[model samples]
Structure formats: C-alpha cells, structure tokens
Target: MTPTDPGQQGPLVEPVPGAPAAVATLHDERALVIADYHAGYEAGLRIERGVDVPSKAESRRERLLSLLERTSVGRLIVCGDLMHSIGDPGGAERGELEVLFESLPSKLSVTLVKGNHDGAIGAWLEGCEIVPGSGTRVADVGVCHGHTWPAREVLESRVVCLGHEHPCVRLEDEVGGSRVEPAWLRGRLEPAAFRGRDEYAGLEWLEGDPARTGSRPVESPAIVVLPAFNELVGGTWINVAGQSFLAPFLPAGIARGEAYLLDGTRLGPYRSV
Candidate 1:
C-alpha cells in the first residue's frame, strides 16, 4: 500500500506565473510549485565554462520572492534539482541556498522532491521537508523530479507532474528562422501499456464515490512535464529527430504528447511534428 500522507486530499491545481518561469499552484493547499532551480549553475558559468558573468544567486532569489509576493502562497514545493552539481553541496552552493531561504517568509513550508541532480541537497535545505528522489504526494497530485520511477502513491494519482527533461520545442520557419522555447508537455497514459509496466502492475485506480456500489473502475492518467524554472537552464528539444524523452515512464508516450508555451499555445503532438 502507498503510505498515506496527511496533506494529499483535495487540491485546486493551476499554473501561475513565477517570473522568468512559471509555477504550478495548488490553490487548496496554498502551495507554489517549481522545478530545477540548479542553484550552483552560476559557478559553472564563471569557472568551468569560462563565462564572464558573476554569481547572481541574490538576483534569482529576488525574482523568486517577487513571484511569492504576487501569489501569497504559504508553501513552496521544489520538484527537484535544487542544486546543479550531482555531488555534495560545496560552500558556495550552500551559502547561496541559505540566502535564498533567508529571504523567504518564515511561516512558509518548503518541500523538496529529490531529483537526479539533487545529491545531498538535504544538507543545504535545513528546515525544509525532504521526500525521496522517487516522489511525493501533495493535494491529490503526484509530483516527481522525473528520473526514476515514482513511488506508488505518485503513480496512482489522477495527475502526475514531472520535471527533469526540461522539455522544449524547436521551431524553424520555412525561411530557416528558428527558435527553441521552454515548454510544458501534456499527454495521456495508454492504459493497457501503462498497466503492463512493472511499477504499476497491481495498483488499482480507486477514485470516485466510496458509498456508491458497482461503479466501473478506471485507469489512465494525465501526465504533465514542467519546463525548467531557471531561464539559464538549457532544454531538451523534444521534436528533433534524435531527441527523446528522459524519464523512464515517459519514453513510451511522450511522442504523443502536445507541447504548450507558458502563454498557453498548443504546438501539437511531438511525434506529428
């Protein structure tokens, strides 16, 4: 059985603008959800990559604060990759994250859903709740950083949210002008195929009225892959010929999914392009 959490009952889910990127909000729980902050990315820019830019952790924190102020939400859920490095948190990485948290409201709760790059991130996130890299349930939605198979709780949710692929669409005009835009990928689960997966084998879909008897049981779920929140982060050009979805659960169905700009334009299924 999927372990029950006290916070995963009812939720009002929607997308909200969170500055350079967007955040998913669960209105019922007063939470703002974001993914892939990649806190130490600036170091890579300045040192390894030989870019002249100085660290801008303070500026990023300010932008995040502005989004929080606009929404007035009490919970911040980072759906993974809070740090860029795939190893331990270094002093620079730790310091920047501390500054990020110090600027936030003291009353707000933060949850970190571990992503592939979030190794030892818990050391940097002192007071926040840390869930497994697999996933965690919040307000009836299953959210993960999209590397490994999510725990059963997340698998059984009506809506499953993912982040790691940093999904984007590459577009070229007939005259050769091209642009790549970070985007959301929305798609449906193929029930027969989804049921065949080892991870979801015996799990049953149990939503709807408990008092009513003999209602038909159902399967299939809507999958939503979020764009990377940091504008600096690169993306997977999903529609390109050799490009592919990264998450294990996504490879089978991602080609059938439609991409959407943050502004909400439907760009059609990835495979069709």
Candidate 2:
C-alpha cells in the first residue's frame, strides 16, 4: 500500500488506474477499507480435493496488517467473502479462520459485510459487524460485495465499493502475450447500460418483503471492485475486447483511463493510460 499524498486529486489515479486497489478519501485517511479477502479459501480447496497447497491465511493477515500500518487507518472494512466455504467446515479451513481471528486486535477495527461465501461462519466472526447486501454506509460511501449489484438507494451513495468478480486487467508486452493483474475500475451508472443483460435482471439480496415494491433501481454502483487478496490467481479482464462479463459497465475500454501500479511502497504511474 502506498501512502496517499495529501494533495493528490483526480477521477482516477495513474499507473494501474482500474486495478483493484483501495483508496483513501481526502477527508479522513485513518478509515481504510478493502473487499474480497476470501481467507482460508485455499484450505477449502485442499479439503474439496486431496491437493496440498501451502496455507496463505497467515500471510494474507500479515499483508493486510502491513497495509493498514502504511495507510495509518483505525478501521478496516472487508466488503465480503471473508470466508470461502458455503456452509461446510473443513479442518484446514477452520485452522485458517482461527489464525485470522486471533490476529485482529493488534491491527485495527475490522468489519465484514456478509457475502455469498460467508454462509456458515456468520456465527464465528468476532470484533466485526456483519452488514447485509443492501450494503453499509461508511462516511458517504456504500460498501458491498459485487456478487449482486445494489438498488438505486445504495448506488446513489457517494461511492459504491465492491469485490466479487475478482476483476483484473490484461497488459500485453512487446511479444504480445499478456498478463492479467487486479485493477480498480470506476465509472458512473447509466440506466441503459444494464437494461438487456440477464445477469443484471434482479438483485440477489433484497431487504424487505418480496411483494413490496415500487421502482427498485438495481444499478451497478459507482463501484470500485477490489481484487481477490488470495494468491490463487485467476480473473476476468476488464480491458479485453468484446468480453461480456464486464462489457455492461466497461464498454469504453479499461486502459484508456488513468492507471496506477502499486509496487510495495511505490505506486508508479502507468504512462500508457
């Protein structure tokens, strides 16, 4: 995590513009938030199959704590998917969770918004508040996990941040093969953009009664989709030509906008964008 300069301002930061990095507002720098941690996911995979993969739970915790230290935040909000199993409890997964739960207090206040993956672990979360997908209001921003888009009221919040698609953008080198890295994508909502897509047909989680209705606007929020913190490494690239998953929102091409590449303590400006 790069320390935010007090004087930076723009619609997007440069280098890896649409990359899935967290942002700090000009007002309060102490409250830092991110999305889609998916802690213990590797352990879940190992249990589902016999494959042995090194546990990443501790490293992920350490990295997040280090990032918090760099950001100097007093609180951390995980938009969703803090756990991987839908409802089953695997031994390795349980151990990973224990490691994470035991390490929180030394860092900062952490909050986990219930995501689709957080099915059973809801009862075990400590030192964190669980918010529904109607989303939670932090300052003026709305935080949600993008497994489902939010309604109009949620979108209208100052900024809607989410994580779920594990969004990444591809960058090709001179030889032509490309590498996909997590990106932070940003764009305002236009009603017409989501009109015809079956994926955007309905909200996955609605707060009130099913019969209760008026015009519920399920717009894609002015979103900042964070990348998966897991090292398993796979994603949908936002910059690819004719890609459908992100086409509804990123039609204009992800690379044409500003980009910032996060390299440890140094965030370099990607001049191409």
Candidate 3:
C-alpha cells in the first residue's frame, strides 16, 4: 500500500509503506513507530487453537527490516505490546523476541512504550529504554501505548500517537454481510471533555509551563490511534455504536474521527460507520 499523505505543516506523521495496520513513520524525525507487534502470536494460536505454527521470528524480522530499509529510519519507536502474553512469555515467544531484536541493526535506536500486555517487558530487552506508563515525547509528537492515562509531557506535542485499542472499522455489504479492516483514527482532542479527569493534568501542566513547548503553539493536539501491526489480533470497531473505547481520552459519547484504509482510502467520519 502507498503511504498516506500527512497534510500538515510541522512534525508530520504519515502512514508508511506498511498499511491497513502498519507502521507510522515520522517524516520530520526520521523515526518509525509501530504498534502491537505481538511477537509470539503463533504461540497463542498453539495454545488456544490447538494448532502448531512454527515461530514467526525470522519472517517478522525480515518484514521489519524491509520497512526500515524503505524508510531508512535510524530509530524505531514501538508504541506497545511487542509481545502477546501479558504474563510470562513462553519459551517460543522469548526466543522469537530475542531473534527479532538481535537481527535489528546495532545503529538503530529502539524505544518501547509500556503497554498493559507488556508485563516486565524489559527482561527481554536488556538495554532498550521503555517509556514510563504515561508515555514519552519525540520532537513535536507524543507517543504512547494507550491502555492508560498519558503523562503530562505527552500532551505538549501537536500530535499524539497511540496504540492498544487496535482500532478498526466494520463495513457492511448490501447483502447484509460485514467485515472488519484495520484503520487509522484521526481526530482533534476536545479540551473540555478532559475536565476533572486525569488526562486534563497534562493540559493543566501546559498552562503553567507555557514555555515548555518553546516556539510551537500549544493548541489542542490531534489524536492518531494506530492500527495493530500484527494482524493476528482482533480489533475494536470505532464506528460501531455503543462500543467502549479502551483509552479514556477518546471522544466521549459521540461518533467521531476519520478512518483511513491501509491503502490510503479515506473512509471519512468514522462515526457513520
């Protein structure tokens, strides 16, 4: 799929060659952001489905290398859930994780945002820096694994990138059949909606530290919820009525945001489903 055009002036984040639930590559930062790698997905299938699939470490590694080669990015920012199991990873899962990271170029800087499913993820990656539970910032962008409240620093960015909801859309055919496809959700944050909530802390902190953002105007930032990188996991259809969002910061009680297909199709106003 073609990369989606990020039509903004500063600190642009665009969907890269991997699409329909792919990597989010930063144009200005020369960095690549991906979510929900779930490295040992085959292990889950083995346990749950009673089906034995070989470890996908080599294939997944090769795929990621191709994306890096395409983007030529020096940094890889994993939003979260690099592994599937929230508890201890099985032997196959651990081996896969080791193989994947070991294959990465030593020159690359890899950052992982702690996700709810990432219990003691550091045991696998000895030196990689894992951001706090709230998330971290890179230039004018904020990155998080989603599942929880973002830290005050994450709000300073003009754009906030997150994962964990595995956002998607359900499309119904005229024949009354429906299918789900991974999608990107882009929407502006309403500051008023955050009032009295923990998320409003970031906004409040920005109030006192007006100089924190330097020259960039600290307007309400846009939220970009990424689709899962691994297709094995199911998704939450953002357009489906009465669907509960995993992230507390999401639009409350409203059909909102635009959904884009992996091939750069603008699904438009996701609220309409």
Candidate 4:
C-alpha cells in the first residue's frame, strides 16, 4: 500500500533505498527514523555469549552520522532500543551515546521512543525527547517500541511504525547453504485481534471514556515493522517454521503481512517467502 499522501496528511514516510532507515515528514519537520540501535551490542555479546569482540561504537556512530547528512533531516526519531542494556548502562555504552549525540548537529532534534532495553537510559541521556514505550502519535504517524500494545492514539493514526522483532529471513540455496538477511514487514492492522478479549488481554478499549464507549476503531492503520539498525543483534526469522513473533500483539494484529529486503525487493507473503 502507498504511504499516506504528504499533501493531505501531516506525515509521510519513505524508506531509504538499500538502507535500514526511513525519512519521515512529521508536520513541517523532516526526520530520519530508525529502530533497535542497540548501541554497545558487542559488550552484550561478550557478557552473554563469551564472545569477546572489539567494540564497533565508532563505526555505528559514523554510520548514523552519514545517514543524517545524506538524508538532511532536521530531526531523528529512534523507535526504540537506543541502548543495549536493560538497566544501569555502564561507562562504555553511555560514552558511546554521548559521543554520538555530540557528533550530531546542535540544531537537529532527537526523539527516542523508550524500548524494553531502555528502561534506565533516561538516567544518563540528556537533550533528547523520550516518549513512553506504549507509543506516541506525531501528526498522522504512530510510533512504538512493539514490546507491548501501543496507545489508542497511536493505533488510530494513518500508519503505525514499530521495532523490537528485528525481523529477518533465512535464504537457503540448492547447495544447502543459507544466509540470514534483515527484512521489513508491512501490513494492515487487524481490528479483531486488538478488540477481542481472547486475542489480547488488558488492551485499553477506553470503554470508560464516555466519548469512546462502545465505539469501534475508526480506522485500521497500516503497520510497518522495522528491521534492527544494529546488525550484531539477533532477529526473528519470519519465514522459518516454529518461529514466533516477539511482540504480544503481532502475528494476530497483522493482516496480509508482506516482507521486503533492504534493497527494496518485495518477497510477497512473509510466511511463504
């Protein structure tokens, strides 16, 4: 489906060719949007898997800086997972973030939609806008971290963007070799899954709000699930059997899910791909 018209709606998002980022226009400001940065991920790998690899913080920072320059966006919107640690981010991770932010133009605004991995980021980060993990609505676009149900306001937008699944696909050749590639998942929201009691519990229907009582959702916004910006992290293999989505509302919330490669190759239905 086509993105919301830039002239009619106050927001528009266009994915950069061969890139993990998208340029979005929110109101009058243009922003570069990315997700699951997972800064200092190498440190996590060392601690969790005993793989002591050298840090790639400089490269990650430079990559982001290059994107900002190429896109010429005035704002940066990180959907979530700006930090690798869930709590008490140490000096290295915090230092990487500081240097990264310092490297950006002083005029560029930054917005971080707090993710499950960013529970304590605010304790050290500064000068950036941090929205609730439930989600936030900026103009006609909705953004969330995708670990839980988005706010009702976010669900009602013309389009919803999220990360956390870090979706990927496995490609196998006739020679029995295979490779994993990052992928983008796009679909329309299924109203039944969000509204039904059994499908997802504790979803706020806002039934107590007199204005919203008994009022079904007015729209089924298109949903865009982003690939992780950090390549070192693991991902959910959407095309693999027995693989399940990490988001609580996903799989059930999506309709006609389609996958696309970073180079813009359409892979048709994600399940079949």
Q: How many steric overlaps are in each model, in order?
A: 0, 16, 1, 0
Clashing pairs in 1: none
Residue lDDT tens for model 1, 1-273: 011121344223456632333344453556767788888788757656788666778777887788788888888888889888788877777888888888889998998999888887776578799998789878567888888877778867766777898988888899999989887777765554455567666676523333574666554556777788777888888888788668876667432477777776677776555
lDDT of each: 0.72, 0.57, 0.75, 0.84
Candidate 4 local Cα displacement, residue 27, angstroms: 2.3
Supply candidate 1's per-residue lDDT for 64. Answer: 79
What's model 1's lDDT at 141? 72
Screening candidate 4 with a backbone cut-off below 3 angstroms (N, C-alpha, C), the clashing residue pairs are none
TM for every model, in the order presented, reads: 0.84, 0.70, 0.84, 0.89
- TM-score between model 2 and native: 0.70
Expressed as tens digits, the lDDT of each residue in 1-273 for candidate 3 is 222324456335777733533344455447778888898888988897998877767777787888888877888988889888888888888888888878888998888998887888886666478986579888767888878878767777667788888988999999999999988888765665555666555464234444764655445666788888887688788889988888876755122478888777888888886
Model 3 TM-score, 2 decimals? 0.84
TM-score of 1: 0.84
Give lDDT tens digits, candidate 4, residues 1-273: 233333454437778878888887787888888999998888888877899989999999998999999999999999999999888877788888999988998999999999999977887799899999988988778999999888877875778889999999998999999999999898888776777444334444311233656655444677888889998897999999899899998898988888988888888899999
Of 2 and 3, the candidate ahead on lDDT is 3
* Model 2: per-residue Cα lDDT over 112-190, one tens digit each: 7777878867676666777775466665567777666554445445556666666566788899988766655444445
Candidate 2 residue 109 Cα shift, in angstroms, is 2.4
Best by TM-score: 4
